[model samples]
Target: MPAERVCAVIPAAGRGTRLGLGIPKIMVEIADGVTVWHVLHERLRPLVEHIHVVMSPEGEGPFRALAAGRIESGAVSVSVQGRPTGMGGAIFGAAPHWDAHGTILVVWGDQAGLSPVTAGRVVEAHEKGLTIPLVPMPDPYVEYELDDDGTLLRVRQSREGDECRPGGLSDVGVFCLSTEGLHEAWTRYLDEAAPGARTGEVNFLPFLPYLSRERGWPLTVVPVTDPDEARGVNTADDLAFARRAHQRWAR
Candidate 1:
């Protein structure tokens, strides 16, 4: 069977207050002439049909300027996420720019060093339902729970006050989902779901298990051998770590 058609949505609305950068962290120069935005855009360009970068109103100008070539070439599009409603809002906010009938690949803007090889593997493995790449992190900010038979039961998120143990399976900030499935699930979430206990906003993580257990959607877990691929450039330390990881990966 041929690989399903896919488009990408990048949620970049965060202001990166933790990095202490005046601008969004996605625009920060991770390396000479290369920004965090550049890394993700370049990595995802060849894998999908097009890229939709969802940014805050404040970030539109800079991001558009950075994505000029790809935008001109019709390989990328930009949309605004009016508020910081979290990841779920960001992905759905860009909904109009993408093909609703095709698969959607959502990647967090701060996530860097994603391996093209592993990305390709996840794309190829996404025959149907939801496909996600899982990485083993020493301290998991968000952990996925799977049953003995490798079935995804639920997800525990530390940001939402869930107790997370050490050495857990975490996502690499990449996901492939069927558009129809996402639409239906998101509709249900909006109507019936409550705001996260800690975040006080709609979250995307919990919906994963909701789709699997409650809605009977198939969840495929692809293992990522390298943990560096899950690095999120949120803080100054994270930015430095990403820079170092980029150098090591470059060699």
Candidate 2:
């Protein structure tokens, strides 16, 4: 009931166990004044109608407190992921908030500074019928080298042109899906896969090649230049990086 055109689901349930912090990683303060998830949800709210935040059972308390303090431009809700099923499961937790026939957008809990303008272009791509927003990684790049625990290193996608070529779109954390799109995403990639499966987290990126091959579902990647648009906080370092980027944006 917030915004009619879209809904955004943020999976914030993962423990930042690697961050060595006892609190939920998503709740960690990345800036002088904001948490990573707050920046993410705030920026994402205007592009969609409603925002559903998925938190682990252990996380619901903090997340609720966090959401309660925000001036949500869109309708905001929270759901508890009852188990540690994986990324797919955290995402599936937000399904109840969606109607069976509308569009939904998704981002990770730790992500910040995604450009709403680019998000809008992604929506336009969907209006034209692309199942996924295939955003072209910027020409000059800031690549995030994420690790099992920390972001290992970041290089320009072009700089690593061999593994991730220039002009080759790397999978960023933002995804917009229809209600049917959300269901399809869950069914096509997650349902058959075992719950708690390691690859269950393959909720987004892995689907692209298959989509390109089979359904011809157009994956549109609107061009984005600032690598800040795709920053996701995993460790303290990433949080620091995103915080600095966000400060620059506020100015």
Candidate 3:
């Protein structure tokens, strides 16, 4: 596939209640008087030919206004997620606007620390196949179980007792997937997911284990040396940390 066909899908539909911010989390100013979404778009613009932003209906106007230049240039497109369906639904909604034959770089909208370098690395690693960026966790929290060759086995959400793997890596919600892999994963999710999965949120994490175990899909794991670079702004503390990190990154 042509590199110019590569598209970016940003899932920004969540209402960040944890952050307690009245506005959309991506719209929150992080540094340099620019919103997190602006920084993300800037980082991704040069790497991909097009960007598709998926946001809640209420945030459409502000988001459009903020991204007016890109929209007018036809490099960026927006879609309103009418209902609260989770990340899976958000990406699925944007699928129609993207070229199904091309690859997609999926990034969380609130990942304020994401840098163009890291995003470019993901795109390069994706040339090998499906890729997911993983960051080392200080504590053994939710993490991905990997094979000896760095293939993802499963996503273990808790490592309380017997499940604990000290110094394991966690998923940072950055994924590089071909359109075929994405469609297959979504299809399997709809066919196999039990009722009320992840509280009725059609998440993409679970599909990793299913595809890896059942279909023998090889999942390449790319280590993100700086964990902070993969952090998403979800809580007040997280937002502060992101702001500081962005400042340091900018310098």
lDDT of 3 by residue, 1-251 (tens): 35686899998988888888777888999876789888888888888888999989898898899889999999899999999877878888788877554788889888888867788888877763578888887764567887787656677654222264677887676888777666766776788775343365555666677666776666776778877765789888988898887777778
Top lDDT model: 1
Off by over 4 Å in 1: 1-4
lDDT (Cα, tens digit) per residue for candidate 1, span 64-170: 99889989999889988888999898888777877554788888888877878887888888878889999888998889998886668878899899987788999
* 1-251 per-residue lDDT for model 2 (tens digits): 23566777788888888788877777888676588776776677677767788888888887787778552544688888887666666766667776543676777777675666776666656752333333455442333333343222222333223255455444457766555554565577554432223333444444433444344444444556655565567667887787787777788
TM-score of each: 0.95, 0.74, 0.90
After TM-score superposition, the amount by which residue 177's alpha carbon in candidate 1 deviates from its true location, in angstroms, is 0.5
Clashes of each: 0, 8, 0
226 in model 2: Cα distance from truth in Å? 2.5
Q: How accurate locally is residue 21 in candidate 3, as Cα lDDT from 0 to 100? A: 73
Instruction: Report lDDT (Cα) of residue 84, candidate 3.
Output: 82
Alpha carbon lDDT of each predicted model: 0.84, 0.61, 0.78
Worst 10 residues of 2 by lDDT: 151-160
Error at 40, model 2, angstroms: 1.8
